[model samples]
Target: MSSTDTIVHILPPLTNQAQVDETYKSKNVTINTQEVTDRPVLRRDNTGLRNFLADSQDNQNVGYDGEVDTLRRLGRFYNWILTFSVVTRYAFYILPVATLLAIPLSIFATIHKESNIKGIKMMGLFVWLEIVWSSLWIAKLCSKTLPRAFRLCCGVISAGTRKHSLMIKALEVPLSIVFWVIACWASIPVIAAFNPETDVTVLGSNVHWIRSLQKGFLASVPVACVFLVEKVVIEFITVNYHRTQFSARIQESKRRMHLFELLYEASTILFAPYCPKFADDDYIINTSLLSTVGKEIQNVTDLQTGTPIRIFDNLGRLGTGVTSVFGNIVSEVTGGQRVDSKSPHAVVSWALERRPASEALARRVFNSLVSEGNDALYQKDIERVLGPDNHHEAEEIFHALDKDANGDVSLEEMTMIVIELGEGRRAMTKSLHDVDRAIKALDRILMCVVLVGAGLIYGTFFSDNFFKNMSLYTTSLMSFSFAFAGTVQEFTGSCIFLFVKHPYDVGDRVEINNVDLVVEHISLLYTVFRRVDSQRKVQIPNIVNNGNWIENISRSQAMSEHFALAISAATTFEEIENLTEELKEFVLADENRRDYKSDIDVEVANVGDMSKLELKINLGYKSNWSNEKLRVARRSKFMCALLATLRKVQINAPGGGDVAIGDASRPAYSVSVSDEEAKISRMKYLDEKESNKYVKDKGI
Candidate 1:
């Protein structure tokens, strides 16, 4: 392909401080998601199947209880069934076929040998050789279905990985026959002598080979040590770190796979960033050196639903609620310490808080509150759990626990509240920041160990390893292998990027070269960020980020945003100050007090071209800019108020001027706005529109 035809992808540049003001002044941006619900529900004619068939299950026989019993029964005898199948397969399929195939090959061997072959010697070697050569072909009876299933699950991925050699494949059957004849003859004459059986004859001579000659394969001992050494080293990491991530990925998929599949169907490009795949421990352990069996699933259901566990009672006791914004709702978390109200670790601490002193009593109470699914609890449930006598307190608790202002207390909220009834506020003295740092440190150490191990193996076994003569070549090979490791790309940048000049960490809202992004994940090699504008994942290598300027909005002490506007030069400085005063009063209102600070800085920036004035304004938000929704909302609210204030002050924006010829000035501008009157008229118009002129819009 020519360079001119090559497609290059570029990240979208975000509207900057200057650009955003221009856009808003011209009223260019349409209504965005920030003003709407997180995700709007689009109504359409029901195209879905009825629940009776889609969720169909026979209550009497196919219930969870019965399904569990059935699985238990099958699991108990599964190993026995597998063992018997393998035995019967070799007895019924392999031996009979190998015997029949060996008949003609034995005849060819004898014709070449000019002597009759012996029993248990010629047949035994032929069987072993036949099994070794034809085993992969025999497995094709089952493997034939694998490619189809793989393609179904992998989507576009299979085409790139699938290999083809048409010339070799065309001669497959004929070449198999020719190779089998030569292999069968050689097996009886040469490799046959190495078989376990004694008194084996070769070339019409009785020859029993010595044991050392038979075990010639042991010469490759040094190369075989790598696998054994790897196993030994891996145990240390397992014992310390545990198999948490792999198991967590599988478990987490139970709740997320359906969503991922829907996203994939919606847009493959958007879904590629969240590719979900799983590997089975059983197959990976000992299946085959080259291939193993696993499933690419279309339909997957959780085997079991997890119930809250007990945390404290001696019967052996079991187990809040601040929510970190946009945390568990997705899978990214920010904020510094787990002790913080909304962090997942705080939820853990709440669960383990030794409440009511009895595990059985706690379970009984929870069961009483929610008899069916222990997910959400309503006001009635709160009354039932706490009793009718403490109804007032129960109401307060219910309201407090309803974090999202949804009517009921969700399971997450229930699990997260930390209770402290009798003491003055003493800060939780501990934080889980060190815990995260420790895990990262351990992961880095493991990465180094794996890299060095791979380099040593490549140098010693694969490359030409000479103690003295080819020492330089071997050393260079090892160096190349080590340097080629994925994490090596981060080596120079990581030290300074993380410790010395660190701009951001995971979950930070940042700006890199004017592109606003939220840090979703940080790895040794690259950082994954989601564009605040488009919500698409962007992977920037650490080495690349090291060369760019980064602004960490989340870490900054103060949070503010500024925008510029071009207003009609006819407006006096007194009118501008009056507009600024209107904004100040708007910020100070009780309803707006929660989200905004009183630090409103509105000023005339410049007298531009004698036709218009440049006005720049900066407003401080109450919270850090980490919450994208709130930041967008606050900016939107302020902008609307600013426009209203400008209208009230008769300050015309620069674009509506009319051409004047001597005394023939044609005034092309008219402005009239009253917030109270507009609200009343808008509500009335909406009611009339819904009653008569409503047009249902489907997203198409």
Candidate 2:
């Protein structure tokens, strides 16, 4: 038998029983195959493999077409809106200026007409010309479409080939020339049309010149207005059309890609037995395949069926398992309570029930976009997938995907998403290499700019400012100018520096002069850090002149803290050893400390002559150790547990051992001491006191 025939033979046949049962249970309408047609049909239009594939293809084509159409429609709508908006805006601005100019111009025109006075007519003509010029200027200022119109014109003229700056410059030159020509042309006609002989002028000038100029100027108004309006409208329409076309193209691309993705997913699922396993047993199937299925279903269901499904495609098997566990816990916790019924979870579920498939597709698409070069997927593509109504939802998904809050997704982010989606480590090393290169290039460019600016200030402005300040009057002006320029330059430089050189960002724990803090604010001139222990804000200037070390403690792989314990002198070394062992076990058993390397060491720090033993317990914590409160609480609990164990074992000496809590709140036990022990204790006390004094002195 042929492979196709063998596959067909192995395939399961659909039966009406399941559908009938579901309909009966839900009390919904059921379509009976037998009642619908007389022939025994092999394929159903709404279900089965063949129908699914055909429907997918058809839907993809429709989606592409729809996207294009929508883009075109929106572009046209915006163009018209922009045109009318600009015209209205310009009209409002010009009306006031025109009114002011009209008073003076009318008075001059009337005087020039009656007396035939040359001076009066000239004055009136100039006033009228001024009014027209002022009106034009006001219109130019008022037109909201000017900037966008200019940009669109530049873009078109440059054929998208020139740099933005060059295109703007190129367009500005022609626009300025056109404006001047139109203004001159309008004035010339007004000057020529004035006829003082037939007109009356009360003042002593020839009314003919004034009337002639006014008439010419008035005639030019219509021409100028038409030109401006036409330009604005044309630019708006062109831009809108271009945008619409671009959107349509993007939509079409996405639709085709989505169809391909669905096909790939289905094929993967169908031929699971033929695919080879790569690395581990866990790596048998690519998680992207499963996610793709969920994503496709989500997209189709959202677009066609309007259902919402909370898909787990973005999560790895382990992540999915954990998520499922947590979800179950959350459900159980809020299941019966009144609060549960009104919770966001309940709302989400209800929303999901209303549109399961759409929600599922959104989840899947979000995960894919975030995990797979989300930057490559533009806002337009998402709009196409989710439809216009759910564009806001797509935006939320995008924000969630950008976990680092960097405004852009990096390979690390993508890997994290893939890991969550259950895709084992793929070849993502190249992406990291690219990111490193980009960072290095940015740093180099910033360093160059800073050096150049510093050089310029030192050579041209610094020395000159001092010399000019010798004269008080000149000094004041020079100082003001210098200060203003410096301020502007500094502000601009700082903004540029932030984009290029990010020393520290929010949520990063840093250390300055041994004082640990979390970065609270990062500005150009200064960096502010909130002390971890006290939450006090510390400000540090970014001394660009001198390179300073800024330690990022959060980036470290591990952080360690020492716990000192002193036991009674009567307590034997053997007892101390046993106690230390117990402490070690407790610290090691802590889930929080599991990630740390197993290199714990416990030793007698000092032995007191009287009956005291000083022991130091060093513990290391993973960098990812979260829950600061819980960590401290756990340390306290460990100490308490050790104390109880010690008491149970009768390890306490005849004289009670004094316990002192140190770093991480780990307890320290101390015993009574003689002269030598006293010297050690005094020295230790002095060292701590000096440290505190130094901190205070430094204003840290």
Candidate 3:
């Protein structure tokens, strides 16, 4: 073939040849058209050639233009939203401040007997003055855009190392509300104090504390309003923006975890050429270079399928993914490139080849240079976009990888060490198991110590004092023995109930006397549960067995039945069947109900006597599903799906099912416990049934 023909075949056609020519001309890079025809044009600069290839590849992709446009539009939209948020936030802040100042100004005007500035005029002037001051104060406090400030503050607070994020969020709301209220009320006293000639009676007869309190209240109001505004703006941004950011951060973390795994696997795969062996006594241990490859494979599995990693052995720590452990690995391998570390293939290969440590060292050197005066080649952008915690973790990993205790790590050292480590690889499962066993042993020892301490205190003081006053050593000994026995029994019984009864563990669905919850924590003394609907944690005493009926929904034999539906009363039995059929199909189709022994039952529960017919659906499912929220959610979804199906069918045949949808409401459902069940529950109580039955039955 001719050289020109070969060049034509290899070089892809460019749409913007004119633009390319112009760029080359501006850079003083020669591009001979006649010479290009004979051979493929190659840039003298490698970086330039790479950029050209990348740009050309991106241009060929159909989605590239659309993605760019979409990103631009989204950026503009976010900016506009941020601007509006800032304006509205400041406006709300100024309103409260203006109102506070107006009260004092009116009092001053009245005292001066100046009719021009007495009522509305004085109020308007003060309002305007406060508005300007408040705006300026807010602007000074949050110099940047409100959203940015909020993100910074919330991000700082949300770091796990700080106090609980939820508690901080909780405190923000009430603190804002309380301080604003106090500040507003304080204005009344400030006005009275400032204007001595002002009639306190004109304000209110109840305004007794004039000078001292009035000024304090007035001064506090504006200051409080500023703080309140800050809190509100921060919370709004946190809920709407920061939440999504945090979720993105979590996803990014998972992605990095997968990359680390891939790198480990790739490293292992490359190490296959070495075929290193270790000896264990008489047996020659042929450890596969692919032994640690499972972690990488699992990470890839999780990323590809979006399944949570099962790190914990059982459901005790359900949803606690392997990402937590693997996250450290990702941080180490990626070093300064965590954002890009999602590329598992690259990470794995790097790890296998022992090039990651060299890359990490280069990154650090580059960063250090940029920190100095090397601004031309290295910039601030070169520094890793690491979360505060991730940055700290990366530093630790770098130090560990340095090996020789030198400030810097070299590729040769890294490769040699990694190869040695890989050769002697052992499964981490045994170590993890040992750790868990140790923790359990510690807990048991702690519990025994607490019980012994309690017993000692009771015997030493209470027993001696009571018996001494009665003048009987024998009685004291007997009392002490009885007390110790009682304490031991109570403690042991609590532990047994927690372990044996297993009403609810850390992640079980339970109902304490009809109050539904998902167990968050299970301890010897108490169980902490999050109410399924409200997501509020409730502490249930282990001593609840003393009277309260503790129902383990996780272990129930039968599923609780409850459902609501509305249909036109004028509808015939045949028409109702169409609706009921849809409902039945929905319930039966649910994955939760797949293991159900019996089919679902849908009945015309009530004829409202009006125009509507109330229908009840009784769906069956395995009771040990252990998530009441999931149960409710599944039922709701089924109902919605059924309703949609019915609507589709009815669309084809007009008036076939003349059903008027009732006011979208959720009615209360009640479950009745039989007398036998109640009696059985009472018999299990610790205290006398007769004495505390009423309180116990009340579910207190």
After superposing candidate 2, which stretches have Cα over 4 Å from the reference? 1-86, 112-500, 522-527, 544-546, 553-700
**Model 3 lDDT per residue over 1-700, tens place:** 6322332333233234233234444754321100001123232222332233335434655221211112356765655555566666566556677777777767746774443323223443454456445545444444333344455677776754232344344444435444444534434433334345555532342333443344444444444444455545434433443343234544544454443343333333333211222011001111111122234421222334454322211111111123233545767865633322223343332333333333442232233322344322211212232334465444544444444333444434344434433221211222223323433543565555545544444454335475455447566668789658866666666655644454544444667777887766555566677897688989877766635677776546556566676765556677667766665655554243333324667687876766577777676653344544445665676657766865754522322353354524634467889999988877877556566666535564
User: Sort by TM-score, best first: what order?
Assistant: 1, 2, 3
All candidates: TM-score? 0.35, 0.31, 0.27
lDDT of each: 0.47, 0.45, 0.44
lDDT of 2 by residue, 100-211 (tens): 7777667766764543344344544565467456645644443433556656767676766334443334344335434644565445434434554343432222455544
- The TM-score of predicted model 1 comes to 0.35
**Which run of 10 residues does model 1 get worst, by summed lDDT?**
310-319
Which of 1 and 2 is ahead in lDDT? 1
RMSD to the hidden true structure, all candidates: 27.1, 22.1, 31.1
Each prediction's total of clashing residue pairs, residues at least 3 apart in sequence or on different chains, is 12, 57, 8
Query: Model 1, clash count?
Result: 12
Model 2 worst lDDT window (10 residues): 29-38
